[model samples]
Target: MGFKNFRFQVVLRVALLVVSIFLFFRLDFKSQYVGTQLALGILIAVQTVWLIVFIERTTERLIKFLNTIKYDDFSENFSSRGEGKIFDELYQRYNEVIRKFRDVRSEKEATAQYFQSVVQHIGIGIITFKKSGEVQLINNAAKRLIQVPSLSRVDHLSAEAPELAKQLLALPAGQSTVIKLWQGKERIPVALYVVDLVLRGEDFRLASIQNIQRELEEKEMEAWQNLIRVLTHEIMNSVTPISSLAGSVAADVQDYLEAQPGEQIVLQREETEDMCMALQTIEKRSQGLVRFVHDFRSMASVPTPKKQLFEVQEMFRQLQMLFQEELLQANILFLIDCRPEGLKVLADRQLLEQVMINLIRNAIHALADQPNKTLQLDAFSDPDSRVVIQVSDNGTGIAEEAQEQIFLPFYTTKATGSGIGLSLSKQIVRAHKGTLTVSSELGKGTAFTLRF
Candidate 1:
């Protein structure tokens, strides 16, 4: 009811009660008059109570409505019946407000759940941390990459890889770095991309991490395999004719020597000796070419990779042993750098070894006659999460012009280079679905990287 109308009703009820009291007092104590006075007294009492209750009802209902909102008791709906029009309208308004609040809460919960699902299922590892290195949020990918069930602080990664931990703590916003970390027997390369964010006036760092070792290895092997097929085809055709030419030259020299009389041959001994030397050279060259072709053929015929997961550190150890004596005699420093120790690759161990051996041999040759020669073998994971094996040398570097064709069979800068070694190496890498790539500077050095 309107305030003015409610006030008018209160006055009317009070006046009626007052009139009843006056009538009860004025009536006589005779039997008929006593009954009529008693009825008036009872009516006054009831009317007085009704007036007070009516005055308090609006305030009482308002309090109850407030309490319902405070306690989120939307299920207890206000009744809109029985009460007058004014009270019924107020009750309906209260129910509508509660309904709106309930809907807002439900929508918020749904949104929170959706974001939580995305964070948990993303492929890239994501970690959010404060300036103090305390981790605020970590996703499933991050946990798998670090091989940890949970992360409380960035420092926790130090036990697995100190460099990785340092990178996580210190990496600048809008920058990225790649590092190698070993999880059990597998050494993985991880790329970290970091950015800074401020949420609710609190500073946080977000990092995205991914392992790219497998992709590098697969691509590197494919390129090498393609190059090997080309070498095998070209060499087979070239080697046959050279072998025939060598035989023909040898036969001609024999005939010339036999056609000359003994004394005449002796008189022309100098020319005969030159012919013999030339023939011998031809025979030697032909034999070497034949051997080169055979090697290339074998390399080209690489069988499907008998892939098995093996630790890269173990492979490095084997390479060190194989080259121990040779490197020592050459007075060269051979260094093996396998970070996080247990880096593993799924590949044919024997074939990969062969490919690496060829690369190391090339590095060794490049270092020959050079002062302060150093060769380094490094194994790690790249940003793409691929396993990378590198052979580097501080030796006479390859010329830029020769770098591109060096992997081709029969193409070499050295007088005695068979050229099949690099081509065959590439083939072996290809068989494993990896890549063999070289980077070199003429005066500085060369590095051959195998990604698998």
Candidate 2:
């Protein structure tokens, strides 16, 4: 129905062509002039040419419209300009298709932008990379967290943090690992979790990175406080009573021996002596037990650090003075190094001094059996600009099993160790928002690192 005009034009052209051809054939060329016969033939040829051009014109326009769609060229606006009903409707359909395509493209772009903003603004660091280590996307959070200048590949992080880069590459999907690295003056305990991703049949891995140092410190403090509370309550309850009863028994023994006639039965010399000895042993052990368990209260009651800026060299000098006699007598070489000489730390001076003393004493004890004793005390800034103090000794290193339990209270490998020094040192560092770590291998040596 829309092609009504077109059908009429086609029928009219066919009728004219047929009539012209018939007349050309019916015309008697023999009687007619040569000029008239030539004119008829020319008319017929013109009508045929017109008809072919008319048909080709419509086909050409239709092909152009389809090409426009195939190439997603929504800018093409088909305007028939009243050519005919057929072309008018065809042009309208083309315009409608282009309009819909434009709408779909706009919607797709908007959706992409929305998600792009979301990924960029998210708090957690995100890194999307290919299996070959080529990084596809690294959000702002990731850049800041990693402190990377420009990340093109995941391996590029090796320059700044080798262990973190290695762990990220080796980590499988749904697996996570925590790495401790310093950032500026703060220590960042980064937790990395990997997820498998396949976009358009291309396999990729997404890693979520977060600084869990605060979370870890919080949890550690909570665990220590909980254990300390339990030990304090239980040990004090059991040991305090034993100590009191032992004291009362000792007094009662003396009373029994000195009792006058009728007050109590007088003990003979040997009996009195045996009872006195038994009471003294009981009293001594009970008092010792009470004091041993009372140490947990110190952990639970660690005061907030009284922070002040202090120089590491000055502190080292004082420590050297304090340990001068012990170090010389043992013939252990003590080396103190402070990079930039003015290296300073903001912390509770006395508390940190205490931690350093504990580490040095442990080093001294460890170096006792080694013939060539060397102890290094170093204070410097790490690659990340964080303050680091190290106490390393060339002595018999701790066993792997003991290393794990070294920070635990009342657990020690040394026969004379109180088992609380390392634990307390760790707590004191925690109060300063720092970490105390030990790395040792059997037959090699031991190093205690303080990172703040």
Which digits, one per residue and each the tens of the lDDT, describe model 2 over residues 329-436? Answer: 999999999997999999999999999999999999999999999999999997657899999999999987887678888898899787888988998998888888
lDDT of each residue in 187-246, candidate 1, tens digit only: 567898999999999999999999876565456446655766787678777766666766
Choose the strongest candidate by TM-score.
2
> Which residue runs does candidate 2 get wrong by more than 4 Å?
1-125, 131-134, 138-191, 196-203, 210-214, 240-244, 247-266
Could you tell me every candidate's TM-score relative to the true structure?
A: 0.50, 0.64
Model 1, C-alpha of 89: deviation from truth (Å): 3.8
Error of 2 at 3 (Å): 33
Residue 66 of model 1, lDDT score: 87
Error of 1 at 400 (Å): 29
Clashing pairs in 2: none
Q: Candidate 2, 388: how far from true, in Å?
A: 1.6
lDDT of 1 at 11: 76
